[model samples]
Target: MTVESAILLLPWIALVALDRRALAGDVELSTLIEPIAARPVPGEYRTSIAYYRAVLALRAKDARSARALLDAVPRPLPRKRHAEAFEYLGALLDVVEGATERTLASAAAHEHGPRRASWLAVRAHAQAASGDVESARATLRMLRALRDPQLDLASVARWELPASRLASELMRGEEHPFR
Candidate 1:
């Protein structure tokens, strides 16, 4: 990797380590967010910074901040570098905030690709949150049909991890139409 790529990769490496630590319930969200956010001009590490910031905000019950930060992420991010961002953004909108319509809309804005499975998962979660069990099940079926073993770690961490912990707390358990 080039020096620039190496430099950019370091923070995410550290973040993955920290996320693993957090998964073990040994670290605090603030501990993760402070270091990442304090780094110089995070635009170079935009997706990582944004993902962790949104995670921290959600952990702190600061949904507004999380939403703003996630919404600000630019689309068509670098194919290699942006996978986590798109995944996390979808989770934040569909699962964390119970914004299914918004998540589906956002996914629609992007051209279809392998990434669609992750997006569809979020849409499923949104549908589930809205009490549309049938639709949610269908979406999940579509997600499963993708047959892509690739998992978006960021999205899984943002949505499934928290949902496993907090259950009904992440999504409000109400249908929110796409706006």
Candidate 2:
């Protein structure tokens, strides 16, 4: 291809790369949120963008924004992977929105998927938030014991790590005395 052709393709190539990174839960993708959101996402990539934004909003404790973003995702997501991610992130949002049952159920159901670590972390959050401290501590112990090499929770669900830690400390009565 000519230099001009390559130049024209650069943006598209970048979008594809970013979309894959987003799917793989690359935390760095969060830095590109503004630029990506400002550009017009092609239909093929719209769901990924929506998912990324929704997850970001959830991490920031902005449930309203998260819900809006998730709702924008097309029903019957464009791909199976996207659908799985949608369900997982939606369950997280439900918990953040004060409905934790779905997250607990999702964590139990997807016990061995690639997202198992994330599921456990969110389950712990749900249990702790709902005043089930003992269950939350047990879930956190399970989360800590898991030896899965694929436990890259920060990439996909950025909130889980902190949420898990907070739940653990709260349950153990070890929270820092200072705010």
Clash counts per candidate, in order, are 1, 0
lDDT of 2 by residue, 1-179 (tens): 43234224543455556654554456666676556556665775667767778867776778899889888766877778788778877877777777887778878898888778768877877887787767766766676577545543333233553355555464456755453
lDDT of candidate model 2 versus the reference: 0.66
Per-residue accuracy of model 1 over 88-164 as CA lDDT, tens digit each: 45465556666767766765554276567656655666666666766765555565466656532233334453222
User: Candidate 2, which ten residues in sequence have the lowest lDDT sum?
Assistant: 153-162
lDDT, model 2, position 48: 71
> By TM-score, how accurate is candidate 2?
0.70
Pairs clashing within candidate 1: 101-178
Top candidate by TM-score: 2
> Cα miss at 29, model 1 (Å)?
6.2
Q: Which ten residues in a row have the lowest lDDT in candidate 1?
A: 161-170
What's the distance in Å from true for residue 168, model 2?
6.8
Per-residue error at 169 for model 1, in Å? 17
